[model samples]
Every structure is written in C-alpha cells, then in structure tokens.
Target: MTRSPATPLPPPGERRRLREAGALTRDQLAERVGVRPATVRAWESGRSTPRGRSGEAYARLLAGLAGAEGGTGEDGARASAPEHSEHSGHSGHPGHHDRRDRQKAGAMAMAMAMVTVRPDRRGGGTAGPEPSAFVQTPPPSALPSDAPDAAADLTPAQAFDALYSFCAPALVRQAYLLTGRRDLARQSVERAFQLAWDRWPEVARDPDPAGWVRAAAYEWALSPWHRFLRRHRQPEPPPPDEDDRALLDVLLHLPPPYRRTLVLYDGVGLGLPETAAETEATTRAAAGRLLHARETVAARLPDLSDPRELHQRLAELASTGRLRSAAPPAVRGGSERRARFWTRAAIAFTVALIGATTLTLRTAPTRYEPPVPPGETVQGVPPPVAPGPLSEEERELRARLRAEFPGGPERLTPQAR
Candidate 1:
C-alpha cells in the first residue's frame, strides 16, 4: 500500500490568523503543539518552520482552527495561500528547511571557530589576543551565558557534561605525554576538570574551552612542584614495547619546557605561536626549544628522523598506556566538595580572626602606660663603718663585763637556775 501524504500546514499569516480567530494564546497553542512559547512565536513570525511530528501536529491544529473559523478562515487562507504554496514548493526550501540547515551549520561552525584561533591574552604596551585559550569575554546560565540560543535551553550541568565528555579522554592522554606518569596524568586531567567545573561559567564563556583545560592540565602535569610529590618521585614501570619505552624515556629526559613545546607542536598539533603563548615564552624561544627537543629525540632514536614519524610515535606511546579520566559527575562532585571545604576553611579563619581582633580591642590598654625608670648608681655614697675593737681601752672592760654578765645572767634568773 502507498504511504499516506503528510498533513499540510496553512500559510504563516493564515496560521496566526486562524489561531487568533480561535482566541488561543501563543502559550496555549505551544502547549498543544508540544513546543516552547518562543518556538510558537517563531512559527507564527515565519522565522522557523515546524517539522516531522511537531510539524504534523501543528498542521492538524491549524486545519482544525481553519475548519472552525469556516468562511473567515477560507478567505484568509485564499489571501495567504499563494505565499505558502510558493514557500513549500521547494520541499525543505531555503526559505524553509535549507534555511534551518544553514542556521544549524552556521551555529556549528561558529562554535568550532570559537574553539580555535583565540586572541592573544598576554598583557603588553599594545593590545591583542590571549589564551587559557586564554581568556573569557558571561550570561549567568551555569555555562557560558552568552552562547548561541541553540544552547540556551540546556541546563548548566548538561552543558558541562557535554564539554567534559568531549575533552576528558583526549586530555588524559595529552597529560600523560607531558608528565610521563600515568597516575599524574590522570590526576592532572581530573584536577583541571575539577577546576573547570568550579569555574564553569568562566570556562564555558572562554574562546577555546578545550584549550583552556589543556593548558591547565599541562601546567599541572609539568609543574616543578610535582617533583616534590612522593607519588611522582618514583619512576613507574616503563612502557611494554622497547621502542615505546625508549621514546618515553627520551621524552622524560627532555627539559620540561622543551618536552612541552615538542608535545604541543608535534604531538597535539598546536602552532608554534600557540605553544609559545601557552608556555608563556616568546615565539623564538618556543621554536628553539622545539628544535632542540626534536634533535634530542632524533639523536636517541635514529630510525624516527622525520617529524611525522616522531609525532606518530608520540601518539602511539600515549595510546599504549591505559590512562583514563574520571567521570564528569564524579569530577564535578569532587570539585564542589573541594570548593566547600575551602569555603568552610576560609569562613572559619575569618571568624577566628574577627574573634581575636575583638578580644584584643576589648582587653587592650586604652591609654599609654608610663614605665618605671630604672635606678642608676649614685656617685660618692658613704660606706658603712665597723666598730674597731670598741676602742682598745674599752675592749678589756667589755670582756670582763661580758664574763661577769654571762654567769650573772643565770644567777639573775634565780628561780629558773
């Protein structure tokens, strides 16, 4: 059996007239049509057309309204009929479907473009571009508030998940190449994502969100401080393949800056300028580092002379290891947990400081106190005199008197004696 023809919709003007004639609000019609009120407005204004199930339902509703309005609906349709017929003549017409496709394509292109070619973010005497890729330029919707209306309907969490899903796995591998430590690589990606989640609105609005995350991850992986971490100090088991192991060892041996430049340019395929900007070095310095790194690698491994071979080998090395990133939800949860911990810590510290200040203010001396002066030695003070043998003439008499009194004292107390 032949398939039935799809339901037909009235002309845009007729669609609105029929709806008005039936006394239905845009909201009411949108609800019946299973779309947003904005969608209904778009339909009536001819900015967008309904399609598939929604379109068929919309057509059925219009047909019913046209039938109900009877003669008035008929006259209005006759008036707008030519335009609608012409508009629909080319199925999925440019003014109709092709227009939508172009719109969708345009939005995609814009998003992609936004992800690349960010302006230099470094501050200087002259104004220019930057990256984190490197800066953001927010509507408040959890993610980038100023993003296209296409993403307007999505919740912040959904948008975050989309970004996380797209960027996380690849980021893990890149982090591994930068640090030469699988666990550290995983940590770097997770921490970066955690940070991204914490500052989601800022990250979402960034010109190149993936690049922003990449920079964060790479920074963590290549940090000088990681050398101090207990887990990172010990060299982990090497790659299984001899070549892979040798390549990884060479990568690890390179100075962090050179390693990063090589990875960014050859492995991740970033431009020299981008690598330099990300590394916070001049373009020349970046070029020199990259050259030095390539030379070092070629010196160690003669077979991998070509840059292409090196790049391919690097990719293979990263792939050989089983590096994995945490789920987006877990990362988001961890980030929130960390944020809350720090928030509590800050609040506690603030409260404690305030209490100390208040206590000090209350108990502190209101006025300056004068301290007692210290005593100093006085000049020419008289010394104490000793009785010198009670004068020699008196000494004999005093001794005789004492001898008599000694015995007389006992005799004087006659009752006790």
Candidate 2:
C-alpha cells in the first residue's frame, strides 16, 4: 500500500508574539534581519515555514529580542508542539504513536480551555438579569455550541475556529462594558476578531489567543471616535439594574487604561503578569493601574467596604447572558472609514482650537503696558500718585534708625542721596 502524504505543519504562533513582545514591527524586523517584508510576513503567517539556517537566524533574533538564550530547544529544534496526523502515522511504531497521542491530548486540552465558557453554577440557573436588549448577543453555556470535540491533529483554521467560537461571547461582553454603547462594543469585538482571523497562523500558536483578542477589543472599544460620535447622539436612560447601572457609570468615569486594567484583572480574572503582557505595560505599571482602579471604584461605591467584594460585584455586573458568535463582519472600505475618522477629529480639534483662541483673546489680562519714560506717562494711562506726608512718629523713627545704623539710610532710600 502507498504511504499517505504528511500534513503541512502549522506556523509557530510565538514568532509573531515574540516580535510584538520585542516591539518590532514587521517592516522593522525585516530591515534588521536583511529579509524582504513579505518574507517575514510569510513566516509569521505560516504561509512559508522557516527552517535550517534561516530558521536558526530567525530564532536567534527573536530570542535576543525577548532576552532569552534561544527561542528553540538546546538542539535548535522548533519549540512549537509537534503536528500529528492520524492518517500518516506508522503502524509498526507503537512507541511513537503513543508519544504523539499524549501530545495531541495535551494540545486538545489547551484548545478546549481556550474556548470553554462555564457559567457560574452557584447562580443555580438563575442567570443574571438581562442587559439592555441591544447589548445582549448570545451566551456560551457549559460548552460553546460550535466547539469541536477534540483538537487531535487539527489544522490552524480548525484551531482558530475553536478558539473564536468559545471566546467571542465573553470578549463581546467585555467590550460592551468598556464602550457602554452596544453597537460600538459589537463593532470593536468584530474588528478584533477580524484581525485575528487574518493572522490566524500567528494567533493559533499563541498561548492565550483569546487574551490577545480581548486586549485588542479593549483598545477598539475605547477609540476616540466614540467621543466624537457622542456629541451627535441623544442620551438614553441608563440600564435598569441599579447595581449594574451604578457600576457601569463609575467605570465610564475611569481613565481608559485604568478601566482596561481593571476589566482585564478583576473582571476577566487575568493574572498580573498576563495582564501586563496584554496591556503592553510593565508589570509595575499594570499593578499601579489596577490599584488606582480599585481605589476609584471603592471611593465611588463606599458601601462596598471590601475591595475584593467590589471586584466581585463589578465582575458580575459586567457579565452578560448572551453574545453573538457569528464570524466577524468583513472589513471593507477601511481606508475610507479611517479617513472619515481623521477628518471629523481634525474638524472638532480645529473648532475647539478656534474657540479656545477666541476665549483667550476675550479673557486675557489687559494688554501689557509699556513702561513710561522717567518724565513721560503712557497715553490714556494714569501716572503714580504722589505719596502723603509721613506721620511725625514715622519720620522720627526713620531719622533715629538712620543715625543708629549709617548703612540703614542707603537701604531705606532706594535712590542714593
């Protein structure tokens, strides 16, 4: 019998993550490594895998950037999990099959974890009150409806699908909390996923693809376009639940980074280290943001004495029962949208600048008057009035002090005698 062809290996996700972690854009990295930008993009996208001399050089560059000894094992082997194929395994090699199976099992477990969305069982099927109708998408239950049973010997697309199906709902809910606008929040989440889909090769290899997407969604939800858009919108009544409405109101008042740090840490339950990674902040900086967020939240909700309880309550308030799991909408006319955004932003900025200039001109202190020549006064300006005669006691005291201290006269009389 003829042997089946081997499955193509998936691109290592670390290549992209490390490049990002190292703060090198694709073009920058390509320039540094003496390669075409397209080559680097290909390597990152897994369209063309790097190996041998090129792979080693690529790994070394990334490792150096990441401050690691090597991006691969000691022997310079790829660190990514080995790709296994059910149809291509040898029947005679039982030991090899067993090892491959074990690896597949571990990979599958990770894949499942990436997508699993377990609801709080303690609520006893009492799902939290529904959010505003526009905000409610679809909720993931014990298992996402689209999740594959196992990730055994899966392709990159399969892996990405599994991840997207599982995490999109939670991500949308998180975006909604950040933006407080249903349409904007949904758009943010969709845009994030769209980017992820386009870079699935890199995303597939990520340790926490969902976390990556969540961070992106946070940025998108908080974009400045929302501020400009708000000017044209009529305000709507707040959500019905007093606790939730109050929590959201407080969240909206927070600085964007502080709010993002809070959502990622307390609301999403991300560890400090991962939170820092996702936020592109130093661990110290991320901690400080989290601290400020908590203090602000506590100050706003004084009845909640315990910070942990406040965190819990905020997390609950952020939770939703539904999210849309469909594929992200296609991104079309991106340049046009960006142009419109910049145009609006510039107009608003110019208007504000003009208004500020007008106010400053109207409210500025009266024009700085030029000093008068010794014998001349300014036009339409009054001269200093002559002083009244000193009282008897003042003259006597000055004379006495001048007699007692000869230098005192010089100090007292600004003009020399």
Candidate 3:
C-alpha cells in the first residue's frame, strides 16, 4: 500500500491545519509560541484571527512546514496565478507579507531596546545603569486611579509586606545614595517602612505611595541624630583607586544643606521645584543651594567641567558603592577632641551662669519701699479732720489752705492751742 501525499496546507489558514497535518501538536505549538494550550485551541478553532506579527509568525511556521514536505513555496505558486487571484487578492500579496514581517521585527527590536536601555534596579552589583537615569514614561493604561486599592484597610504586617514588596529596595537605594552608608541606608529604609506601616491608611491614600516613602527616607537621613553620628564617626573614604575619588572628594567638601540639594537635583534628576518639595525648602533656596554645591564641587574637581558629566559620574559611583569608600574624613581626631572639650567647657560655663543667676535672685533685697519727699509724712499719722461740714466755697478755701501749708488743719489752728 502506498502512503498518500500529505494534504497541502492553505497559506495563512487557521492553526488547525497544522494540527490536522500533524506538523505540530497543540502542546508543541503552544510551547514554541510561549502561550497556553487554551490559546492554541483558540487559534485553531478560528474563534479569533491572529493579526500583525502573530499572524506573520503563524504564516512563517506554515511555510516552513510546506517547504520541509517538498511542496511548492506557498507564495511562489500563488504569484504565477492571475493578478486578481481570488484566494490571494483579499488577504494580501507576498510583498505585503514580507513588509508586515519587517514591521513586526522592527517593533520587537524597539521593545527589546527599551527593555535593555532601562536602568538597573539592583544597582551595579548585577548590571545596567541606575534606575533613576531612565525616563519613566508611564503608559496611559497604567492609571493608578483605576487600580484596585491593594493596600486598603490592611493590617500593619500586611501593609508593611506590601510596602516592602513595592518600595523597600528603592528606598534602600535612595537612602544609600543620600547617606553614602549601607548600614545607615538599611536603618533609614527600615525606619521609613515602619513609619509607613504605622500610618498605612494615610499612606495608602496618597497620590504616590512610593514618593511618600522616598520623602520619609530623606527625612530619616537628615535627622539630627544621623547628622551628629555622621559628624562624629570617621567613615572610611571610597577606595582611592577608583576614578570617582575626585568627584567624591568634591562632594565631601560641600556643606550638608548644599550637598543634599545637589544630590536631590542632579543625582536624582529632580527639578528645582521638586527638589524644594523633597527638601522642604523654597524653590529659590533650593536652587541657590544646588548652585552653591555645584560651584563648590566644580572648584574642587575642575576636571569635571560639565554638570551633566559630573552627575553621571556620581550616579555611577553611587551605584558601585565606590562613592562612600571614597569620601574624605570630615574632621581629624584632634579637632574632634578639641570640639568635645569646648562643648564640655561651654556646658560648664552655662551651668555656672545659671547657678549664679539663681543665687543672685534668691539673696537680693526683699523690701521695695518708695522714697518720699523731705516734708512728706508717713501713713502712720492720722489725718486731721475739718471742724464741720463745709460748703463748696469753704471746701475750695480749705484746699487752698492745705496747698499753702501741707500740714493742713494743724498749721491753721492757733499756735500751740
């Protein structure tokens, strides 16, 4: 018995043709296409038609199968037919098919480029650039306003879990960038998440929960204790071997306010207004701080002429953890000891002054009598009375008499009588 010739599959027909011809099983096709078996069934049953690149892929798959079986090329045989061939007219010409394939490939390339061009989410430890460097253009379909409240009425643990899942790594990175200390970064991020957990309802209601957490991390980084600790602790500089040492040295010279402003603006690519919002300063003040910071850094690192180049360098340094190891010590041990001694001396002087003030206040005179004129009498003496009720005229005369002799009736009485 001779084997029958395999059925000639129609060009760009339903995926069922492959199933019937045994070119590919449903599972095999689904696996190759990276889709579920249910999707394969959908294509084969003609519930919906594949379009664009998907359709092209299907057509290519069919053409390869036909070529393998020693059949005429799907398009070659069709091309020799009448110009208005009924089968090929409505669908599209071979040239059109090739164009579509090219378009599909172009789109895929663009998508892959976008993915590859994106910044590294996990710092330079893995690969790629910093995530902040990417221009995040959110899709219109990604409107958070329409998203279900994933964080609504959640318990503290649940809220924290969600926050950690969404924000912890980003927060850690921001903290590390701001503080340039891994331990501090971890502390800052953890504290920020704790605070968010404490106020989840309010945080969940915010327009941007991630932004809120980021702001919190910044605040934690700027706290007085953190500042004090940074001042007192002599953190080792970033490796002197790194190329970014010059930049790090310049940044270390910047005053805290200026450094923070510059980092938020240049390192984070935030606008002046946004930096102001983040730093809790006025826009003009933020701009001035940033300007001063850049000026200081530029003066220190003249090699970094361009502000953008400096920013990129700093970002890379931060990503690589080389920036922290490159920082110059803020102050020497001798100077720190002198500062502590002066601080103690000032405290002692303040205590002495307070004691002296208290003693002076307690031992001062208690009497507060007012001085009297030479002729004035004390309250002890009884006042003299008029002999009788006087008319208005008599009252006026008595007043004049009193004015003339302040001793009053005593002076008017007969002498010694």
Q: Residue pairs in steric clash, candidate 3?
A: 237-325, 237-326, 238-325, 238-326, 238-327
For lDDT, the strongest prediction is 1
Q: Rank the candidates by lDDT, best first.
A: 1, 2, 3
lDDT of 3 by residue, 239-295 (tens): 333455666667656776787787766675555677788788998999889888877
Question: Clashing pairs in model 2?
Answer: 137-323, 138-322, 138-323, 139-322
RMSD in angstroms, all models?
A: 21.0, 27.4, 25.3
Model 3 — which ten-residue stretch has the worst lDDT? 322-331
**For residues 1-417, what per-residue lDDT tens digits would candidate 2 score against the true structure?**
432213332335777777755645555676777776557766875777665555556766876765653443553343322322322344345444455454444344544566423233345343332222212223333222222423455655555555665566667777767767666666787778777776777877787677677777888888877667764285635665565677888888999889888877666655677778788999999999988888888787774445544544554454532346456233323423655788999999999999999999999889697888578655987878998999999999878886875554345547677
Stretches of model 3 off by over 4 angstroms after superposition: 1-162, 227-234, 322-417
lDDT for each residue of candidate 1 in 312-386, tens digit (9 for 90 to 100):
567667766776678878988999999999999999999999999999999999999999999999889899897
Would you list the C-alpha lDDT of every candidate in the order shown? 0.72, 0.62, 0.56
Off by over 4 Å in 1: 1-150, 377-417
lDDT comparison, 1 vs 3, better candidate = 1
Listed per model in order, the count of residue pairs whose N, CA or C atoms clash below 3 Å is 8, 4, 5
